[model samples]
Target: MALVVKYIVDGYHDLMDNKSDPRVNDWFLMSSPFYTLGICLGYVYIVKVLGPKFMESRKPFELKTLLIFYNLFQVIFSSWLFYESCVAGWLTHYSYRCQPVDYSRTPLAMRMVRGCWWYYISKFTEFLDTFFFVLRKKYDHVSTLHVIHHGVMPMSVWFGVKFTPGGHSTFFGFLNTFVHIIMYSYYLLAALGPRYQRYLWWKKYLTAIQMVQFILVMVHAFQLLFIDCNYPKAFVWWIGMHAVMFYFLFSNFYKETYNRNQARKEAKAAAAKAAALNGKPQNGVHQNGVEKNGSQKIGICFTSQTALYEHSSNTNGVKSVTNGYTSEETKTLRNRAFVPNGN
Candidate 1:
């Protein structure tokens, strides 16, 4: 096992240390696979195992202020990263395609390199997301998808910075930072309190935003394969495939959550309509198999049959069904019930 570990570490060092742009070597954790692997494994063990276990005997921490500040910090951090990405890529030096890593000491290229490192480091900061969940005892929030997304990012992006930083591929980080700005803004608002709940109705749209981001990333990455860009085709393929995978995962989650919710709503509506037609109010099903007026029910009237009927008021002011059918309004009743009510 020690020999195997030694070989793997040596290989990682050789690939990262020798081949990586020298400009990025001084950047923190830029060429250190050991640090990246250690941080990720430590994050997993803490959040998934140790944190939960420790919290089992303790009360969940109400870190409301801490969370609010943390979210605010992320918003600021993401905004800075996004600005840097724009300035380095779009605003100045980028051609949008085949933009190879500028290993020279030019200001714009170095700025982009720094931006790439920042973006890579940002992935490590995201570990706090799971930590926050563990501290709050919101273990449900720490899902498999969430863990994988956070845990894999640092290691995956480390390569991007180490090898192909400040290239056409940098768009991934740029777009991601833009998305994070919005996402962290949402988190910030949500952390505020109940007062912001109304504005948070757009929470459902966040998933849509993520799907759009994934689509955009996939398109951008896939475009490289068709064009004759100098950018590494293998990296492009990897990014494109990664984006596609996330797109499908997020799509399934969206459908399972929102689509099922919608289906449930439709089913409830159908059930309510059936109940109303059968003279069974949804609020409460009477033991006597009769619909009583003044009982609040959802959307429609409850009637036993489509034929002639009468509703009479008892002394208690509750409307009860009677056998006698009133001659008046009979045609109107038939039109409302047996006939189609569509306009």
Candidate 2:
């Protein structure tokens, strides 16, 4: 752990000293292997081939404990990012962009470098987000949106560090970290259970906030694109994909989860009302029997033939209508005619 920390510290120092990036040298290190292993593990877990019984044992999700730790981690992580963005923004505004970048230049600037690395690390930490879902057996929540969001973020951030490392990305790093501060904080509380369930008013709005983040990211990235700056276009491509995918998936989710759902409910209600007025079963409904054991109701129950005749000239008669069997067939089938008890 000490050696690893020293290596990270050295990586930053090398970047500051204008030496070659240590990441290139460390590509085959033990930590690199672990990262690959973690990604493989994530793939297996997401695919549900990792074993269910093990995951099930972790269910009945203890929200309180989960959120407590989750928020605690958020506080520290977001705080650092908030500070990093502020410091980077400060230096870039003043004189850091065009200078040779001396080590003694600015206290805040060094902090920003550290923050850049911190932001890179935070992306991988977010893998825990999916781990929690898997453990909770909320596999349905793991959609294309979730997997793509989780997988690509860390990689993009790492590319951020390897390429541009600072500038407008700080704004994004800052805003996203800020959002995460609120988001993970909410998740933490939500995990605490029903006591906090009533407090989850902004659940839908979280996606809106994410969309806002992408807009902000697009705006900031275009800043470097317009002016002379060091941020990578490759990283921009990655970020662009993230934004586009988020928009598509989230919009679809909103449409399906809310709009289309309400439309379906309304259509069903209208059909039911029409059926009631016609004195017949609805298009897919039946009044005679309820759905039982996943089976649709037949609604073919027979009543006493004479009692049910629309205008009974003779109670003993049988007549089949265009829509259905006659009252007498119903009575005969039900054995509801002839016997005193049946009648």
Candidate 3:
């Protein structure tokens, strides 16, 4: 046991001495991985366990103003990160096909290092997203995907800053920062209230763009395997696999939320069309059903079918009129229903 412990400790120190970036060794949260890992674990515990329990008996806090400012800050911060990433490497000198880490103290290289550190710091601030959800009692938003994504990010990026601060793998951070810019902009508009809701019709597209980002990252990183790139193979595989994993996760979420709802709407329209062709009520109600103001009443026990017939006759068979449109007009409207593709 003693020999095993000594061997593990020796191996860890050797990796740190040989593989870690010495320039960031003295920087905040860079001295060791333990600090960042500890903070991440604490974040998960609070969001998943402690937060919900505390809010169980309490009223949700009104955070409209806070959310507005928070989202605004995120949008501006993400924009700055995107700009820095471009200026430091992507727009200026970095190659998309193959780029290796510049470990020297050159001006552009050090700028990339600083940008990477700030990106790492940004992950910690994102914990506020979950905290706000918990405080608002919006527990459904703190889903397994949300928690896992936020929880692992800090530590995952820590290695990049520690070993390869600026290289091919930084492309992931570049794309992610860009995505956050658009994402927080949406959130900022949403926090402004119902008037801004109209602009939020593109919410589903946000996920689509995110998926696109992952595919780009995957292609950029995985291509390093086939060609001779000066970048580290381990980091290449690491970054590419992360993209692959997230793409599938986001795709599943899209299918469940948007595709399923669309399928349900289509099914309802089909049923209504079938009913119309059969000379029955076309608006999802039975002919023998009692109708009040063109809507069917539930659980109203009529004494007999004759009573139901009498009620239908008095109401003129419920009129088949909805929102000033006749049954034929409503059918036309349904046929012309807008199935959104994109902006």
lDDT (C-alpha) at residue 342 in model 2: 24
Q: Candidate 2: where are CA atoms >4 Å away?
A: 1-48, 51-64, 90-105, 223-232, 268-343
CA lDDT scores, all candidates in order: 0.78, 0.61, 0.85
Clash list (residue pairs), candidate 3: none
- Which residue runs of candidate 3 sit more than 4 Å off their true CA positions? 275-343
- Sort all candidates by lDDT, best to worst: 3, 1, 2
> For residues 264-328, what per-residue lDDT tens digits would candidate 2 score against the true structure?
99998998888787766555454543223334333333554334434435536555555344444
lDDT of 2 at 59: 49
Tens digit of per-residue lDDT, candidate 1, span 60-83: 998999989999999999999999
Candidate 3 local Cα displacement, residue 181, angstroms: 0.7
* Candidate closest to the true structure, highest lDDT: 3
> By TM-score, is 2 or 3 better?
3
Task: Assess candidate 1 and give its lDDT.
Answer: 0.78
Clashes of 3: 0
The lDDT, on a scale of 0 to 1, for candidate 2 is 0.61
Candidate 1, number of clashes: 0
Query: How far off is residue 66 in model 2, in Å?
Result: 2.8
* Candidate 1, residue 172: how far the Cα is off, in Å: 0.6
TM-score between candidate 2 and the true structure: 0.63
